[model samples]
Target: QNTTSFGLTPCPKWNPNGTTIAGNSSGLKGNDTSSLDRPIGIFVDVSDNNALYVADHENSRLMKFNRSQHQDQGEAIVPSGIISAESVFLDREKSIYVAGGGKVMKVIVSGVGETILDGETEGEIGFHELSMTLYGIVVDSNDSLYISDGSYHRVVKWEKNSTNGTLIAGVTGEYGDDSTHLDFPHGIYVDFDYDALYVADINNNRIQRFHPIGNLTGETVAGGNGHGNGLGQF
Candidate 1:
């Protein structure tokens, strides 16, 4: 669902033990259409009857699990050509965005896939020139894409039908724990109402918030102290 609210709503206290709504309860991995192998990214399409879309990474495809039906098996939606699918996002129009294999693809529910951004290919207008190892992807209300380029250690914003992407956070090819730097950024989320971008800075073990309006340097929102099992640690 599209939201215009800023900041996160505190989740109500619930049971610590959670139920497995999809996939095998034993955590077994499989390559079949009914099972998932190294599924990395997931998006719940609340608008579409709460259908859960998964980036079936190792299987190189996308899977859709219907919540209403409470099915254990997921239907393979985009059945092929999404090698090492790392992340998946669904826009307001129900268009699917997939990130994998140094490329980002746009796919419809009917299974038509189009490569919109190819990091391996060069010299194409509106295509990124850098070799991107994409991890996370989120599309804004305007259909602009915010992607975490793991190889580049940065986050970039690709305007809808634009020439190239603009750097949103971190420096290209640089990694650091400083405010202006990031290391192997993974998941990314855009708050439309806040006009901010949240990044899971993987290597740095922190979460960063970047405001595209004026500030290029980001602020640490969580887990910047150090890696540990204790509180306030990553």
Candidate 2:
């Protein structure tokens, strides 16, 4: 299944790396110390001259790998919970973003992960308290960011340097049509080449595509009925 030693969801996707797609899922398990998590989610940092950063959240650290000489070689650059992280995200500048414990943190190369969108991001967006789970994040070329608020059952979009997210899809919990329907949405990806938006509607067992902007009122990418295998026609 997985070519790498392991795999992780909520992937730390890169900005269209050349060949390989580097990322990890999670190393989290229970409250106990032993059953804790493992290192998951690594990204190929071609932007940083082909480097790697692993969000080993459960073990409480981050791993940086040198891809030039050893593609698989790495070192834990930052310790876990150093940025109050649960998930890791890397921007174009090789800056890392981690979302965990109601916060999304940003980590610079020379410095640490300062809180970029957390307490204030929540307050401004009015999505903090209302939503229980927030996962599935994707960014366009310009810096526009989108996040899937699982608990509240909505997909929200926020332009860079903006505080609040404009609700663009699933504005209400009333699930009926393909456009305005989503439940427990997991992974969201944007096909920049086609200006298409792909969403892993987990609960719905399908993937949906929308225009560059959030307008889910059209045809579906995968379908509204069942899970997809990534090799079929619309």
Candidate 3:
């Protein structure tokens, strides 16, 4: 699910009225296991019959929806321990990773969750700290994790089995619309082939592409013309 192949041309038209495969069609919200509350992040497991995993934010849990069975109600896989789970990611090993409560946690299906990166813990890098206001989580092919720290206004890279994270994009604790900065970054994606990272600069209303190898500054690939209803706006 983490890997993506785009086949559409630029400015491709999409269906405005999309069908709802899971959750209430009427936009109803509930805390019940059958329903979801403030689901923030979703990952589709293509290998697992296209099963969808959602980070139920307000519910503080992870929900799994099986598309093969046409199930409307999602099963609570990780029921608790992740307060305000903002994002979820699944590695090739089938281990689930969650970002919430100022930490990144790893949980196996039907098992307890373990904190892999805690904000309170001192990072191995100099003066770098993981913030509680984490939004998106994605793992690269090398098993390293990339997370968007909303409060810190930057994206961090945590190597496998590493306690500290390296600042891959944006300045630490700084927010801006400049190429060298980011404002409340949300979702993140890694293009392994290009060796680049794409970040959803939420407040900046743009998508940025950053090369993690040697360059920290980002190039605006789309939507930097301010927020509006225009076709080029975001």
Q: Which model scores highest in TM-score?
A: 3
* Superposition error at 177 for model 2 (Å): 7.5
Write model 3 residue lDDT over 48-148, tens digit each, in one string. 99999998888888888999998788887777545668898998878899887677788876576787777754554242467767788988667788888
TM-score of 2: 0.64
| Model 2 error, position 23 (Å) | 12
Which stretches of model 3 miss by more than 4 angstroms? Answer: 9-11, 109-112, 121-128, 212-214
lDDT of 1 by residue, 1-234 (tens): 253333655965658998876677788988776677778888887767888888888888888899989788888777755556889888777788988777788987567888887665554423264444678898878787788888778887888787678888888778899999999998987877777889999888889998863367899999998888676778
Best by lDDT: 3
Determine the C-alpha RMSD for candidate 2 after optimal superposition of all C-alphas.
8.3
- TM-scores vs. true structure, each candidate: 0.89, 0.64, 0.90
Would you list the C-alpha lDDT of every candidate in the order shown?
0.79, 0.56, 0.82
RMSD of each: 3.1, 8.3, 2.6
Off-target runs (Cα >4 Å) in candidate 2 are 1-42, 47-52, 57-61, 67-74, 82-86, 119-132, 172-177, 227-234
- In candidate 2, what are the lDDT values of residues 45-119, reduced to their tens digit? 565666766555556655666666644334555555554333455766656665545555666867665655653
- How accurate locally is residue 206 in candidate 2, as Cα lDDT from 0 to 100? 66
